[model samples]
Target: MSDQLNTRQARRQAQKKKQNSNNKGKSKKQLIKKIAIATAIAIAVAIIATGITVFAIISNAPELDEEQLMLTQGALMYDQNDEFVSQLESSERRMNVSISDVPSVVQDAFIAVEDIRFRDHFGIDIRRLFGAVAANITDGFGAEGASTITQQLVKNLFLENDKLMSRKIQEQYLAIKLEQQYSKDQILEMYLNQIYLGSGVYGIELASQRYFNKTVEELSLADAALLAGIPRRPSFYDPTVNPEAAESRRNLVLSLMVQHGKITEEEAAEAEAISIEEQLDVTEREAYAYEAFYNLVLNELEEIDGITSSDIYNSGLKVYTTLDTDAQEHVETVLQTSEYIQNYPDNEDFQAAITLLDTETGQIKAVGSGREDSGQQRGFNYATEAKRQIGSTAKPLLDYGPAIEYLQWSTGHMITDEPHSYSDGTEINNFDGTFQGRMSMRRALAASRNVPAVKALQEVGTDRAKEFGEQLGMSIDTMHESYGLGAIPLSTKDLAGAYAAFGNNGTYTQPYSVRKVEFPDGRVLEFEPESQMAMSDYTAYMVTDMLKTAVTDGTGGTANISGLPMAGKTGTTNFDRDTREQYNIPANAAPDIWFAGYTTKYTAAVWTGFNQHSENNYFPSQDSSRQIAQQIFKAVVEEVSSTIETPDFTMPNSVVRVGVERSTGYYQVILRQVVRLFMNYLYVVMSRLEYQKNLSTLNLLAI
Candidate 1:
């Protein structure tokens, strides 16, 4: 009985212990389950938060403009007469073609290389996106791009190119919207049209034309593959720029087509074997005939508010320029024809630039950038771009103009033309290497005497001279006396526009190329240069009179147009002693020569020289080369003046002609006083002699 009782008690104790162990195991399992539930809740919350953020960003994305998906038109340029000149040069060169015109093989070539799943996916390819994300995570950000054709199209049309997350979200959102609106065929067609290909080409059609000189419809499999590869890296895969790299890229595209089962392996092999150069028949787009003027118009367009170079090329903008086609043609003829510019150097490297402007309006009538057409689009525009040392042309604008304006000096004002030096002991010499002792300002200016010009600038003060020059559209940044001799460089455009102040009765208008810009949105931007008074009327007249003497009997004589009332100046810049010694240049050789002149109706500036000056590349001392600028100026003015009725430069009422002694440059009033005093002395002498004779006779009678 006792053992039974003990055994029952032990069993009861064992049961209690087993029950406690079971309760502990249940508590452990319950804690783990709670932890798992919390973790799942956190993940679910995070996913919901991300979804909300993405939806917010997508909702704020830009609305797609269906019209922008169409082909964009290039800007149109017109002349002063409103006649079409040429289409403005743009970075985007596109020729739109319908989807039907593109061959199936060419379409498949793009689809295979650009986006293999283009046909089946929505605008955003989820599989490709996930693969790109995984690749990025494994490597780094931007390791791969998963943008579909639709995404790229939307980015090009409506989105800024950046790597921002918001931009990516918006791009994807727009792509989806675009897919919902257009069919797959339509999207592909738009992509082919909007995609940027190599060599400034924007579409497959233009790419076909640019590379093969053929249409997209006529492209072979290899040709289509070559074009298809360029959009990936346009410059790197440009056939003309990098033929080998382009061929390799093309082969890769062909292989991709085979892998995607769009083309047979045999077809891919055959296409890869063909050399890119063999199929290439590069068609260079012909530049506009008036490319110089067109380039000027384009430059002006860039300055307009809200107008960019892309807008000028793709916005279908209409630009009316100040170009007078007849004058432009005549100017070109004069610069190109040997007969007109008989003094042009025989060397092909010799270049010339000229700018002609209407006197009163400051309109750029014509511009000649080079003596010979370079046949390059937007080549160096010397007329507006090349700034060379103006030489002695600075005399009238920098030195004497300020002198007369500030000092009220007349044309007869005297200046000594002798060996001189600045206060800093810098020697100044005349161009002819000899100096006249003293002469009227008119004679000094007409002869372009360097010493007198420097002296005039000294008397007027460099500060005042610079201020005066600035009023005339010159950017004078130096206070040195050499500036008086045109050590400062200026373009033909600046010279021509500045000289117009004299003919315009002291009014200066900034020269402009484009008259107006008309946008596709019906907004017109007219560019009318504001007129400012650069000098007093009498000051202008005085300078004009002196310049007239320069043209008639001075260094500018070579540029004079017969029977045309004109005022002009000539300028020549020389190499320094060190340069001359280094290059073994002759004493008479110059780097740049200029003739800036204006008739009553027009103003023109001509510059002639080698683009760069070396011992063998300089303008020789020969009459033809040295006087080439003058001769060209004469021809250009003669041609342009034939069409306009040129009148004489009108003298203002405040300007009066005064007589002065040519020898002494003394005023006529002072000479008249001397004559009167001399006559009075003679009369007194005669009266005194008569009195002496009468006294002598009286003395004789007394004796």
Candidate 2:
């Protein structure tokens, strides 16, 4: 009875233990089920969030202008004779070729260097992208580029060169779209065509021609490898300038080709041993030799409506300038063949500038800013930018013109040429030390008498003279009394325009360089000069008549062009204070000289001086600044006279010729001559008496 009772108890205890074990198993399974459900919900939420982000990025993408993708063409410049001058460089050199046309080695070499997985990826390579991100985080800067060829093409064509995250994302998106639109071969072709190689060379075709003097199909394995290396850093790897670096880069490309199974080990080794110098055939590119003229054309083209300077330099439009090729060539020849240029001073301080303008239309016919061969480190445009004192050239613009217009002074009107003091307490004297007392306006101006010019300015009032000068395009806005003596600074170009007004019947026309710009699509933008009446025809005629007298028989006699009816003025500034300060000199001497002259056909101005304002200590024998001007003027005028008949200056009805005796009208003229004659006779008699006394004294000594 006791055994049975014990057995029953043990069985009950076992059953209870079994039931507890089963309950624990069920609890473990339920816990695992809850955890799995929570994890699945979290994963679903994450996927939904990722989809939302991608959708937002795609929906808010910025719109791109398709026209911007079109390749930029360079502008062509032509002379007036329709001769090709130069091409204004704009975009890259490019020649599109199909994948079949490209050598297999060429395609393989570029693929190995630029992008190894170019064929397998769909625009963006996720594995390479993640790897690049990790490397960029670990390194100081991001040196690894995971961009595929498709990505690069899209970034170059459709996006700016910004390295921000947003730009990268846009680039990726556009690259994916481009990949869908175009085949892999097509993208590769575009990439090869659009990339910049070096030395202003763009595209593989141009690079092949420039470096190897061969086409893409003619390239060897070594040649292909070398060209593939240049697009990475053109300047640093340029075969001509840096052959060692270029060779190193080429060897690296060959090694990459070997690693990528594109080229065998033996082939890579052989190509690596090849010299880039042997393959290089760099030649000087054809360019325009006229620097100032090219610069002027570029400057003028910048002001057009649809064209910018970029268009002139890169868009490949044709620019037809107002430059007459014959005139330009003649002017350049005259300046280069001049005795002054042949024997130019060794000192950098000395420089010369000349500008010629057409009277019929204010076209800049020819410009010589500096020596054509001067390899000057500092670019000083003496014709347009450098301003120097014009001296007596101001006589016509500031003194005589204003005097005739406002004070009703005629060419023969009497004006005293004695020393004069202005209201500002400034005193001025004539060019020569001794003045002729009094002289007619024509003689004063022709002789370039400083005192007379100052007095004339006073008669017309300095304020009025300033206005009159400004109207004629002279930049004389100073209130100083010395302005009548050409103390104001002006450029040769500005002076040329101001002088052209006199020949153009008092009409001030703005000078222009480019006559017209034609677009690649045959659209034309023409340039018309702006003109305004600057002075009365009568006043201009009077001033011109006085200037003609100057060239004929006055201070400007050096500039007389025989058989050419011309009028001009000569200006010389004696010892500039600025020059003295610059050189720390004790005395002042004339440093700046100018000759401004005009005919009915053209007006020209020549400036000669030291760029550094050197002291006037040294003087050359054969080439004084004035003599140089005379040579230049004669040469250019003779060339122009060959083409056109020399026309006479038209006289206006308001100007009438009135003759006057040389020594009769003014108070000092007759009286000074008579007194001078009597004094001369008395001196002769006294000298004869003194001689007799000396002779008598000698005879007494001998006795």
Candidate 3:
């Protein structure tokens, strides 16, 4: 009876255990099903939310109006001869070629490099987009861009060049709309024309002409591939300026072309065999040349009545500049080869500037800041901006020109070159400290004597002198005696214009680079330079004649040409210790050198100095500045000699050449004191004796 009871209890327990195990299995299965349903519901919500967001994005995106997609056709600048000089700095510089004008090979080149599925895709490539997203997620940010040609066109035309996610999202929305609105060929044509290639060249047409000197329809396969690679990173892959980088880019394009079956492997190999240098027809970039001349043009344009820099840079207006491309190239070559520029120990720190202007029209022919890679920022051309103390180059504008004009002083007028103390207790000294005692105004100016210049400035009141300089286009800020010695600062352009007045027969026509502008709608605006008769023709001739002595036998003697009648002034501002200390700069920093002069056809200014303080700023000798200026002048004279004739200054009817005794002088009018007058006359006699002695010594040497 006990065993039967035990067996029954055990069986009951086993049954209960089996039932509990079955219930547990059923609950676990039900729980798994509920979890699965919840997960499915969450996934559905995510999909619906994503769909709603995309719908909202597309619905709210901007319309594809024709105006919304209007392209920026930047300004084109032409030289005087109507040949393309360069495309000015602009947001876009495109020459739109129709699909018919664009060759098949050119299209293929862009497609293979930029977007292989460009024709097949509606607008955006899903595979590429997802891959780019994956890459970004993996690598954090900006890991890749999978922009198709359509997307690029949208980004360039409709949006600012931003790389944010918002931009990308908007890019896709507009690209899809663009694909729907325009035909495939239309979209492709727009893409080809609206893209930015290197060196301010936009579109395939301009790019082809710029790189290979060919039209889009005439591009060879290699040329096409090379151009297509530039929009990737214009500056980094500039074919003309950065060839090694360009070659690598070109090869990648060629390889892509072969992989896409657009070109055969053998064909790509042949194209690759041709070196970048051999394939590229362009020898040098005209972009920097354009920047140099355009900076000057931009300044003048700002003064126009209805023009702004924005209008010139963004509008499709055509700018006709007075820039002589050949002359500009020549000047660049001369600067590169000149001794001061070439022999400078520190290549990066030393700076020089050159400005050439047409004397008759006041047209800027050429300009350079320093070397090609002087780290000069755009629009800050040192040629037009570096207003260094102009040194003795100011003597003619400040002292001689005014003295001859207002004071009725002749070149032969006697002057004392001894040190003088002004009423303000300021002492004036000659450059070398040893005075020549007395000299003719012509001799004093030729030698750039500080005392004589100050005396002349005093004779013509400083106020009047400043007025005269202003009329000639100089900015004379101070009326101090030191102003006579070029303590007043001025730019190379200002000095060149001032000197050009002498060559222009005393007419100061404001310097200009843009001669005319043609808007896209066929409206033409002409630029006429504002000019005035700043001085009499007689005075201009007299001053120019006196300046001739400088080139022939004075400080600028090295600047003389064998058969050219050129006149110029050499200005060397010796290092000012006090000024250096005041500025807390190096002792070698204060000195600035200049050569301002003009021929019958052209006037030029050349300046040499350290742009920034450097240990190598020490000039080789006292005459080193003048020697350097002469080298530059000779080079330029030789360059343009064949093109323009060096004519003599026209003698005006009002001027009369006369000889006078060294003692009977125009002295009392300048100095009120009789004793001072006698001393000045005595110095004149002493200078004449010294001049005669030098003349005799030269004659003996010749014998």
Number of the top TM-score candidate:
1
Q: What clash pairs does model 2 have?
A: 73-315, 73-316, 74-316, 75-316, 75-317, 89-313, 89-314, 90-314, 575-589, 575-590
Candidate 1 lDDT, 327-408, residue by residue in tens: 8888878877866766566676788899999889998988998865432222457898779999999898888889878877
lDDT (CA) per prediction:
0.80, 0.72, 0.74
Q: Which lDDT value does model 1 have at 464?
A: 91
lDDT of 1: 0.80
lDDT of 3 at 326: 84
Cα misplacement distance, residue 451 of candidate 2 (Å): 0.9
TM-score of each: 0.64, 0.58, 0.58
- Count of residue pairs whose backbone atoms collide, per candidate: 0, 10, 0
- Give Cα distance to truth, residue 619, candidate 3, Å: 2.8
Runs of candidate 1 exceeding 4 Å displacement: 1-70, 89-285, 373-378, 669-703
Location of the lowest summed lDDT over 10 successive residues in candidate 1: 680-689
**Model 3 residue 378 distance off true place after TM-score fit, in angstroms:** 5.7
